[model samples]
Target: MKTNVAQLIELPKFLDKRGNLSFIEEFKHLPFKIERAYWVYDVPGGEVRGGHAYKDNQEFIVALSGSFDVLLDDGIEKKVFSLNRSYYGLYIPKGIWREISNFSTNSLALILASTSYNQEDYIYDYNYFRNYMHEKD
Candidate 1:
């Protein structure tokens, strides 16, 4: 299993006196084309959102408001990203275990996915993930 993780996308910020606008358009600014969009909200502080890995979906996560931390584990190393800016996004590739937590009040986590929702694509079990990842090779 390959556990290579890196930042792949960044939203462009257009600074203006009127208002600061940041945009992320699929296939134009994002690497993988977007097929779905979702946002996490109404989450109590210290609650976790995700604890799964995708088989073939790529996602770009942005903190539209407030702040939160994303814990990424590629089976080898772990990385944490504190997302607090709406103008910036963290690009997460496939096959990485992710956990989103520590949300501040009124925080919004916007995610742009490369694929539409598919229950079969989610590996929710940690041991299943390890086995499936090993079999992929």
Candidate 2:
């Protein structure tokens, strides 16, 4: 898998006098089918999350409220993405190590996954992830 396959996705947004609305469709806004959906919220100050890669699961991460940064490492390069909009998201392909940090207060992170929860699909150790990338090459 190419490390640069990760991309930023912009969803359809509609502005109204009352409020703004945005929606995401599986296989339309995202490149894959939606099988699982979850959110991370109420994270305390200076707290961080996600330090692993998925062997097969791809993810689309969106900030529903507040802001946060996603650090993506492809074993050769690293990039930081700041998400602060509900209509925008980060598409994380499989085999890329990712970390979420620098969260603003009361930030809500919504993650849409392409697959269900599977323990065997996760690569938690950085060294193991590097080896896995080497093997893929």
Candidate 3:
């Protein structure tokens, strides 16, 4: 598995006088099928979230309301992605550590996941995640 598989994806958008609309279809815009969806909202400024890595699940994160930054680490390198547009999203592949921070006021984060909630698939410790990556190599 490649370490730097994370990337930004743009969704289809239609502009109108009433308002703007964007839509994402599973397996069309994303590489994986969408099985679950959730959102994060009302996060305080400068707060951080998602200090873990998924073993099998993939995720796509979008800023539905405001702006925020996603820190991605592949155990050897790190990168930061800013999501401010509703039509754009960050696609996170499996086995990469992710942290969301630097949230703007009233930012809404919508996350589309490839799987349902599974506690056993998550690796929350940084040291353990590095070890897992090393084993994969």
Candidate 4:
């Protein structure tokens, strides 16, 4: 069983005095190899995203616009990330429960996943998730 762990993802910095431009390449910029990419937006404040954990999938998230939080829990320790920068990203390892909330209107949450969509890989129920983790012991 895997668990959520707090990790930092390095951001790409572009050099330009007048007009700067930075780009994030899926597998190149992020540490773990990426197999999928997705972004979240058009959300109202107070609306929360993410309440599930993956079996082996890892993710790296970024705030492309506005600001929001990346809340993580390893079924034990919890942490929050306030992302307002376009250049920074958060790395979320597998087995961790995650939530993206407190979106500041029109915020864009970009995510790079380590695996393609696999319904069976998702653990949506909290109790089941806990039980699954314990079963691994």
Candidate 5:
């Protein structure tokens, strides 16, 4: 079984005397096209988000402000990534379970997706997701 692992992508940062700049162009900095964009904020303390995995959609997540930790699991292995910069993003592939946690105060999370919203694409059960990934092997 091959479990795809997420990787960190450093976006272009153009420093200027006025302010800093960063950009992520679809198919240029990401492995997929940008079909959707969203942001997560106002998360209550001690609360977590993203307890599911997508079947066909790929996502790129960035910490636009503050910091947070992303846990990725692929049935056989698990890794944690700390996102604390606006110029860097985590590229999450399909079939991998992801969870977001430990968000700092007033943190902003920007997510770029490859596909539009689809309820059927979500895998909400951990056991079901594990089996589904292995079945592909």
Candidate 6:
């Protein structure tokens, strides 16, 4: 299996006196076509979300309302991405672990996935992910 690195992608932002607008079109602004769309909100303070890795799903996460931090681990290395802008998003490929935390009040996180929900495609154990990555190489 091939490994993909996480990256920050900038979206097109249009400035106007009325309000600022940003958008992401399927396969135009993202690496993969969107098969599913989801949003996370109403997170209490000091709470965290996401604690798993996808087997073949890639995602692009955007902070549409407030700020949050994304912790990504690719078995051997880990990185943190701070998302506080609507025009910037973090793109995470498959075979990586992710966690979201430190959300501000009324924060809205929009996620676009390349695949639909599949129970068997999730790896929630860090040790299992490490072993799986090792075995793949």
Q: Which candidate tops lDDT?
A: 2
Per-residue alpha-carbon lDDT of candidate 1 for residues 38-99, written as tens digits (9 for 90 to 100): 99999976789999999999888999999999999877678999999998788888998999
Which ten-residue region of model 5 has the weakest summed lDDT? 1-10
Model 5, 132: alpha-carbon shift in Å?
0.6
The predicted structure with the larger TM-score, 1 or 6, is 6
lDDT of 2 at 83: 98
Residue 89, model 6: Cα distance from true site in angstroms: 0.7
What's the distance in Å from true for residue 82, model 6? 0.3
- The reply for model 1, stretches above 4 Å from the true place, is 1-4
User: What's the lDDT for all of these models?
Assistant: 0.86, 0.93, 0.92, 0.82, 0.92, 0.92
TM-scores for all predictions: 0.91, 0.96, 0.95, 0.87, 0.95, 0.96
Q: Per-residue lDDT tens digits of candidate 2, residues 8-65?
A: 8888999999999999998788888999999999988888899999999999999999
* lDDT comparing candidate 2 with the true structure: 0.93
Against the correct fold, how does model 3 do in TM-score?
Answer: 0.95
Off by over 4 Å in 3: 1-4
TM-score of 2: 0.96
Worst 10 residues of 3 by lDDT: 1-10
Error of 2 at 60 (Å): 0.1
- As a whole number from 0 to 100, the lDDT of residue 120 in candidate 5 is 98
Question: Worst lDDT window (10 residues) for model 1?
Answer: 1-10
Residue-level lDDT of model 5, residues 31-95, one tens digit each, is: 88899999999888889999999999999999999999999998889999999999999999998
Cα lDDT, model 5, residue 47: 91
Off by over 4 Å in 2: 1-4
Worst 10 residues of 4 by lDDT: 1-10
lDDT of 1: 0.86
Please identify which of the two predictions, 2 or 4, would achieve the higher lDDT against the true structure. Answer: 2
